[model samples]
Target: MPVPRPFPPRPFHGWRVVQAAFVLAIFAWGIGFYGVGLYIQTLSASRAWPVAWLSAAVTFHFLVSAGLVALLPDWHRRFGIAAVTRAGALASALGLLGWGWAPHPWLLAPAAALTGVGWALCSGAAINAMLMPWFDRRRPAALAMAYNGASIGGIAMTPFWAWLIAGWGFGAATAVVAALLLAVVWPLAGLVLGRSPAEFGQHADGEAAARPPPAVAPAAARDRAALLRDARFIGLSAAFAIGLFAQMGLVTHLVSLLAPVLGVQGAGFAVSLVTVFALLGRTVTGWLLPQGEKRRLAAAATFVTQVAGSLALLLGGDQAWLLLLGCALFGIGVGNLLSLPPLIVQAEFPPAEVGRVVALMQAINQALYALAPLGFGLMRDVGSTAAAIGLALALQVLAGILVLRRPAP
Candidate 1:
């Protein structure tokens, strides 16, 4: 007699979590992060606000969000992911509405602060916490798929917002986007994200029923304190801080940089192109590169491309082809920059400590990168656009060097 065919593999809940995280990331990054530059341009044109002043609002948003991200580990433990995310969704809606209706520049500050809080709850840190419990062997792939939502967000929203503001006015356009956020994100949080695998009697990666859950050492206060002083953590923080500072500054000014040459719509498309290549970069790294040193080296290389991209834009002048080429090279590294940090922490640190370490690093990175737009904007106001961009490029080069240096033993 022929043997019975082997049973099909059971479905993994981790993949489900990844799907939920993907959707959440789309809204979080699309509206919360990537959309800010669009807002800055619209508000500046319509209200005649100074670019530096409007950019400061974006900086404030990041500062508040960074502070909240630093507290996420404790918040996740106390409130659960579902509650935190749901609350974030509500806050984001309100923040968007407030931003749309704000009558003066000062009013934008509180609105941005609210958005910051919502972003801290719903973005990368939230994705990490949700997926960590349900993945191990497949974590990198899961993260890559989930985080690609961020690039997709940039692809979808940049042009849409530009068109929306052009047609419907900024206030109405902002209101519509806010409604979309609530409708899309709230239900997903309730359905797929609240509970961990253990809560439902499942193992990570859907391993055999007989397999025991991995034991994670609880992170002690002293351990966290020690991490603060650790050379590796310090190195990672410095590299990413400088890297993101440059990246954010360039991206925030990208539309303004390209608009004179490409017009508003063309500039939006250029931003989308950057995200498209970013998606490809993250996908290739996740699929082909093994975790650890190879991944770290790949990340370092991406920053080098970012430096090259910056130089191209600066030198390309008003040539559309050259500017687009520069964006393509820069985009190749964007997603990897966002996705690699948590992966590196997960690979190097203890499982229990991963959350805290990631939180701390994110907090520090956000705090530094928050200054990018404001600094770049001020430079643009006082110096030439080329001077502003040149400064950003120099920072990217510094970051590349810092990241390439091997950590101390």
Candidate 2:
């Protein structure tokens, strides 16, 4: 296929489509993903649930979310992305409602797991596949912006949830959030997400359904077999796993931990502030992302940030500012990590295969990510919370060291 010289490449309409996707992505991430951490303190206080059990719920949430990503590619191939996302949104609403009103611990755990899976469908695996045809040159930055939606949601929802729980209680809050999601995001997806910018003839792929979309990474590189054999992929994946490990373990109980650091009253504000910085971190790093070699560069940056964030966790203070710094660094690094591996996967595979292959990687690593929290919580059960955090940080340091491979530069 020839690269036709369009008079002005992509125009305003293309940007409109990408912006729509970006908004939808942020809404999904905020309400669906980041919102979970906000509920932990309230849930625990109301039920007197042991941290370990709730930790399992968190693990199970990731398990379901990751499982959906691993499975949804085949689903999309059969049912289409729009259909799957709509179903995901509806399912998520159901799960969220169940979570807010459930009487038993068993009920809440399963409800959270279902929502996790639903989120996986719309936001995790399906998002990139949906946006592939929108813009050519600025996909990563756009994706970065989209992924930052969760951070925004996290920042925004934390205080709102705190207030809702304080004002009307958890049951009413959940119902309100669920109803809003059903009313807002579901309809938006129906209206805005059907056609990529390509359908409008103002995209990198033009209006031709048969035209190839812009590749995810610089494709003028080695073949898959050769690329896999390079060891860089392995190193990068390991480093990313470290970040995921830390993120999964800590984020599950962030509110709980911060309460001790900054009283129960201030914990919500602290978490929200951290999320605000997290969103800034992603936005800033995304702006700094290099045009070429985004894969390796991201791998390197993820290694550094995870290692640094892990080391910084020991810096505790009753004041909110220090804890906020830790969360910001961790959030930014992990958010970018979500976008990074897909770049390599995109480089190595076609657009159709991007979701599936990335799902494969996610399945392998997500299990590891999920287990970190469970294990850490068990250690905390033994009166060794510090020890648990220490072990996680050590593992991250080791992963970072392993990331130092000598590629053919």
Candidate 3:
């Protein structure tokens, strides 16, 4: 009663890392991912280049990023996170400048490739790796929170790029954003990414002492070669690849599909709605996700929900409400699709192997989904929006089944 209250515990430094990672996701997806669309449109109009050629360059960009993403763990281990992140920031800045300044059509190739290298280092796998050493039991929530930056990136960057390009022209706008990226990322790398839990003399999730690692499958593989042979790894990779392929395809085509029903502005709003729900979905899942195991089940359930959304869109036809409803349902699972994989890896694989496993899976997933726009476009041209959406639904269903499957003990 009369005694003085004890001091409150110190704030977790890992939360600062989470904040840094969040900012990294914003820039990573904002420029590296969503910025591709801006490059495609601006370059095509300004250079009078063929849309197909520019699109091919974008595809190449993603492919290069996918290839390099597989090597990120090795790079991180060799170079350290701060060094690698700062290097990526420099590369990305230069690449953006290249995107705006490159005069000839063929010049886009090298520019795209350079951007891809930067993208791989800053992308989801890197985000997962950054957080892994600092978080354990609470990682689901941590990842969910961190990955929300991606959705935010899409929401913020699209309009920002458009406005800047309109006023300053593409080259000037690109230069300004690139400089901004460097200013923000350099300090972040030094301040947050460079350090670790042990360095801070703290435990993950702010525990007083370090906890024992969770139980992993006896069949879990320790090395990349062994992981390639593991059934669990295969299943996880396949599930995510299939789901993402469908998702990217649908999202790429969504605006055109809805334009007739909702007009361009309305369709844009729908896409923004999807991003909002994606952020909301991930936040809820992070809070509710069980401590260990069941992550696969949660992932499967996400795909199933997406499958329903696909069905609703397939049937929505001229009904705007129904289409909007489909978008909300589909969007609810979008963030989970990206955030759950690393969590699943953490649950099923050894801690030491988490970075490698996540990297490889991300690479595979990115490589496959890079084709979604073209694949879904072909489906739309060959048939109709319904046809494309139907294919997405089928893929989501397959993903659900695959995620639920486990290899024999």
Candidate 4:
């Protein structure tokens, strides 16, 4: 009998990177994104800050972060992902602590801005840049697994912070959360985000044997100005800008919207449910969909769901079931909002240009979404929750239409 050849080992390292990215996503979104609503509430109660002012600070946070994110490609090339993430972790920790302990309300803007810096480094843009090189054939699955951390963050941390703030006060609760963030994120950034697969003599998806790298087309030498002139980029940016504006606006106000009707604990539960459905939606899409034209369709469908959810919220009144249902439906597309934009860019753009394109897209998306909270808060201040939510629903409907437009072949 002929001797059997030895089987090669599976590539496990890439998965390690995925795992670390998952943890990083949890911290980044949990503390920076979902936690914003809680901060607004706490500051409103403790410091008597108006909702609009607090919401504006949140907008400022995103504006600054968008500028930082626009520079991510150059930053990664110069300093590497690990260094970038490390700086982000430290900044996030310090910012959180500052936010918790600020004696005067005036300090909140700067603190929020600092936290924004951390967010830019740890957000989806950073996650995509880190994981893209490690995954190809499995890119969808890897991204789904990592981005789901955002949902998990909402599920786990929202209630945890709500409870912690209730029990220990905002200052103590925030400090503890910040400490935990540093403890978890610093080590992971150091250990797994240090290098890409190629740097360690591996290929994407951890292929067991070495093979010649695939030939890549030389990226267009056009600068950001030329890229801005591209029709496809403009279409993608406008679609997502409107979509995220509605989504983020609703999310920022979700807890407050439900609190009067559902009570604080009930509102927290609704937010968690939204996140649970978001996780489910992203996970299901990853398993069911292929990686190309279908992405836009999926994203468009999700936007429609958000529109329906917003309408439900507008009409639900004080009915707990309707509110919960609205949150669940709205959440069906939440995770996809973050995941699809990058995937679409990957599909439409050249591999060499993916980083810059993704960065620019993120910047525009952030800039527009940054206004969501301020606008929503202003509406809430001047009108009823239903009216504010109705405006958001309209925005989502418009976004859905924008995204549904078929691209030229």
By lDDT, the best candidate is 3
Cα lDDT of model 1 by residue, 75-140, tens digit:
889988888999898888888877788998899999998899989999888888888888877788
Better of 1 and 3 by TM-score: 3
lDDT tens readout by residue for model 3, 312-339: 8989989999999999989988889999
- Model 3 residue 63 CA deviation (Å) reads 0.4
Q: lDDT of all the models against the reference?
A: 0.84, 0.66, 0.89, 0.85
lDDT of 2: 0.66
> After superposition, which runs of candidate 3 have C-alpha atoms over 4 Å from their true positions?
1-10, 212-221
Q: Give the TM-score of candidate 4.
A: 0.91
Off by over 4 Å in 4: 1-10, 209-216, 381-384, 406-409
How far in Å is the alpha carbon of 125 misplaced in model 1?
A: 1.4
How far residue 405's Cα lies from its native spot in candidate 2, in Å, is 4.2
lDDT of 2 at 338: 71
Give me the candidate number with maximum TM-score.
Answer: 3
Q: List the residue pairs that clash in candidate 3.
A: none
Return the candidate ranking by TM-score, descending: 3, 4, 1, 2
Off by over 4 Å in 2: 1-14, 47-53, 205-236, 254-270, 292-294, 315-325, 348-352, 381-385, 401-409
